[model samples]
Target chain A: MKKINIKFWFVGLILVSFLSCSDNETETLFPDAPANRAAQRNAELLDLLLSQPNGFKGVYFTKNDEFGGFTYYLRFNADGTVDMTSDFDTETAVESSSYEVRLGTTTELVFTTRNHIQKVSDPSYQPLIGTGFKGTSVFQYFTNDNGTITLRDIRNRDSGTLVLTPANFSNFETESVASVETSLANRDAFINSTAVTAFPFLSVEAGGNLTEFALNYDGVRLFANPTKFNDDGSIADEEFGIAFTEDGLIISPALDVDGVLINEFTFDGSSGFEYVATKEGVTAKIGYGNAPVTPLDAYAFGVRATAGVFNMDERFKSSTAFNNFYDAFAEFLLNTYSVVVGNVVFWDLNNGGQPYIEFITNAGRFWWDLDFEVTNGIVVFTPTGNTNASAGVTAIFQPLLDAFIGAPSGYYLLNTGTYLNFSNRTYSMINVDDPTMTINYWDFSY
Target chain B: MKKYTYIVFAFMILAFAMACDDGSDAVGESQIDTTPPILNDLDVWLRGNFVSPYNIEILYKWDINDTDIDRFLHPPFESSVRPVAEALQKAWIEPYTQVGGENFIKKIAPRQFTLVGSFNFNPNSPTITLGLAEAGTKITLFNIDFLDFTNINDIKRPLKTVHHEYGHILNQNIPFDVTYGEINPADYTAQWFNRSDAEARELGYITAYGSSQAGEDFVEMVSEMLTNSKEDFDAIVESISDEESKGIIRQKEAMVVDYYKTNFGIDLYELQALTEAATQELVN
Candidate 1:
């Protein structure tokens, strides 16, 4: 068996002086001072006592007297509590202890439970010492927004003078408390200053035909439309904008059609003005909110009410948001429908009713006709017509038919008959069966 | 008259002695034979006095040759004989039982078999040096080194080898489900061995050495999962290369998950997480 040896060293020195007289002669030097003078001296004494080190808080490192080399750090809280932890096997042995600070000519720190006391030899100045320091052998005084003091043995060569200095506490405090408020104020300023003079709308800007057009702001674009306007003075578009209202911008298409207020738009300093889109009859609400204006913050919003034709391309940059939307839509399609796509697929809005999807597979092309209607927070999808080869309609295309309805308030349909077309190693959107859709397409090769 | 009487008595005594020595009479009928050595004390000491924490039963057989007594008893002195056996039992049997169980020991029953001086080989499985009977008895010509067991941390080779061979024995007794093969397709090969150690580690397997064969690979996975610390396993995974290693790592991970779910009814990910957390605390 091998024995492990450890060395320990005593730290700090205390010096005391005594007054002595040679002879036992009876001599009294002002045995009783005047009452006024005594009162004055007591006041001075109280001021001096208050100035001495009273309590300590920060980090404390303890070395075993028997097994000298191993050191453990105890984190101390401002309320005079210490966290005692073991070096070996942390699962079963970590514990905490409490202490009290006693102030006097010589500062003393008393461990409440064990009655162990140690005098404070070092006084390090800090800016925000929430509580005063008390005498303790190892005292780490940590200020609220200032710094920290590290206590160590001054005598040992390996462990010399306990260093007391301010840590980078300012950085920690700023991040923990002040940063949130700062971000909110910045966001409010940005929204108030940058106003949308011309809202995005479905127009013939590309080729004199109604298609999805994004209103680019500060190089960031939002998918929206100015398709129709309200008879009232307030402008009604993909988003609503009242000249003077609590909500920065309001966009509700349901107000005219359903005669119900399904969405309410509001903005705060923290999250810039947002439109909360909910169902008329139901309690469910889903919409987008802007992020606080900070260099590090990433903005995101949740889609609460997903119905009919909800376009994800309206959320953020096309490259990132569009791909994510497609992925999500693919997953939703797999979960909802049993139809398979093999060859040519076409979206026909020729009759000017609700648009329908026609696809050609090995079993030949089948048309799944749909009727779009918006009610409350939901975009209800209804099927129309009957076409089958057997005794009756073989399969009802309710799921596919439901996918063409209008989305919630924050979102808008890119185009009435916009089809995500994939054919012959090319991906494109055929809008309104127009040939210009092929010209204004996103080419992956580009 | 007295001389004649004496002659007649002598003659009568000689005739009686001659008559008593009949052809059927036996010579020295009170012959004694030495009693065979009573093994009562030895049995009591082995069974009652010496307790195996692993709960293994002890059986003793006298060697006609007397050559194996010193090797089997180990350390030689009569007082230390039981202690040496106890030490060997703790060093080897205890770890096995703790990791496996009493059922494992039972699976390896009586725990002893005779050793032959002559060399023998299995024709079908030429690589197998030792043979175990269906009754849980093993026969080997050579003795295992107890002192060299200190290299238990060498997870790449020796320690892993012992654990793997033992795994085969256990697997043989209680056959694993065939579903284990579905995790990593049958196309998997030791060609992973051709890869550098760095490349293999990235894939999450313990060592490139494991990619040698499917059988060895399976055993390696079991041994590493059961014995090695999480830090050691993680270090190996972190050291692997980016490109060629992911497939191997994915395969190994799937295999380990399957093994735990199929055999022990424990979540492999949860255990791995716990082991990793414990190891991190130690290092930090």
Candidate 2:
């Protein structure tokens, strides 16, 4: 019995060992090794990225609710390098850096080096300060259809979506970079041009749907006050950020007017400053008109009143009627008291919501409170009282101060034009009674 | 029974051999990359100049893993990397080798250097960090992209950081007298940034940052002395108002000089002179 038991025990041990070392059926579940599959996927994704003959064009929104979207052109090389350019800044200069397509939880495309795309995500980028532009350098494959590849930021999937399409290098060169540069130059010219202070409002008609966008001052934002009230018993204003592309301009968060989607518009100055947008065999022509589709007086002035102080422009100081009045006063002050008049600014929602006008001078800044009303298309100002800080300077230049603060009619807040950038525009404050006594001021909120 | 045992043992061996065979002979190559890194001209120069000689690895490319995640930083441009590296070699390494010993940097120095293009801006603080030395093994220099080689002050800024951080490495190797901290313990404060350099000098410190702690105080003295000419350092010492403060600073300076002599047999003043000369030559 003992001999038989020993033989049985040896046989059982061998059986268990063989069973433990055997490969499981799990190998059949996957046709190829996980490592090899991942490597192949990485190669394919890289090939797809480099397959574009010219390059890839992409649009990215820094923040869903904030400054709209930015356009980027990128060319990927197999040698772990990438060339990138953007429409955000005037430089539009191409930047070269390294990139990698590697497998993580999913296939990821990472900008591994400092480039234009990385700058949007860099907190050290000056414009955004500590928060940056709320962008990301690591992107995961989202979709590939109809020659367009969509990559979503892995870290901030909800922040924005970046869609890439095969781009012709020459088209981007001529239409986007050169076009953006031209638009930028024109933007600067528009701001400084005194000949035409009035900018035309854009009327977009898409799929038989008509919507009007008033080109806000600063030249990049289009504002539309609601004609219909919301369920909350409040009228909401829709605003979109606009930027110049290689061939034309793109309006971020493509507007969904009724059922028609209208976002991108092409502009060719060959037939005047005309813009057109097309989608699914339907075309939308954006025509410019002198009068705003939506009246802007109450909306514009009301927003500016509470936004921040309006800084007086040098144009105001140099205008004939206003300059004649102020230059003599400035000369008198400089010749007699040796105190120079610097500039003047208007502030609302200051001093417990009381409107005030401040006269900045070489000696110091002085302020006098005023009562103002935002009427149909203008503001009427009446100086009420002077503060202790203004008492001394006000005693010397009370007449000049009163003339600026107490014009016959308050200033008509007129939109001069918009810039290629979004959010803010420039406005000229013309004396309602005397257009020559005009002051073109910038919004000092930023 | 012995014959039966032999038969069982033979069968067991046969079973083991069968268990080991999986029937597949195709060994897969390791998908993990074993390839050498692609080196540009700047990288080749760095390897030849710093790596082969001193075992130093200069990282000028942007790698988020190599930096503090909370702070905003970037990699130095290829154009900016070589100039700063050359400056470090001329001003810091060559001078130290000449003054201390030929193998001074090769044996006891940071093995890795990280170059950053932008200033290391702190989110919570108003100040920006120019450089950081980690555990005597690594040194990260910031604002290399902004360095104007023609400007003496800008050139001194990073060189000062190198000397200052290296001072800490030396201190780690052979600590300064513990009594050094007791010299002005009452003056050290966490709120050093609130105090101006003039005020710190009046309180027996070379810089406001030196007033934070004893280790920083020693390093700041090393940095300030090495970066500035002997005349400038003396002028600063003389500018202090209180006679008692001046005496205390003189005492600290004496300990520093003595620390080098008794510990490493190095003339601190000679190293400082060589450093200053190298730095001046660099800008000129």
Candidate closest to the true structure, highest DockQ: 2
Which 10-residue span in candidate 1 chain A carries the lowest summed lDDT?
A9-18
The interface root-mean-square deviation of each model, in the order shown, is 42.2, 3.5
Worst 10 contiguous positions by lDDT, candidate 2 chain A: A219-228
- TM-score of the A chain in model 2: 0.58
Write one digit per residue (lDDT tens) for candidate 1, span A1-446.
Answer: 11121111111111111112123447856644344344434333323222223222122222211111111223334544434332111221324444433322222232332111111111111210110011223222112222333333322213222222222233422231232233223323322333211122222212232222232222111113333333453443333221112222223222332344533333433432223333444221112212111111111111211112223333222223233434564565456654343422323333344445454434456665555443322223344664332322233333232222212221221222232552212122211111111111111111
TM-score of chain B of each: 0.46, 0.93
Q: Which stretches of candidate 2 lie over 4 Å from their true place?
A: A2-24, A27-31, A60-66, A77-81, A93-115, A118-127, A130-157, A160-163, A170-176, A179-231, A235-243, A247-377, A380-446, B1-21, B24-27
Give the true-contact fraction for every prediction, in order.
Answer: 0.00, 0.23
Please provide, for model 2 over B10-55, each residue's C-alpha lDDT reduced to its tens digit, 9 standing for 90 to 100.
8977777776777786686886745576666777899999999999
Off by over 4 Å in 1: A1-446, B1-104, B107-110, B113-143, B146-162, B182-209, B242-247, B250-254, B257-284
TM-scores vs. true structure, each candidate: 0.24, 0.72
User: Candidate 2 DockQ score?
Assistant: 0.30
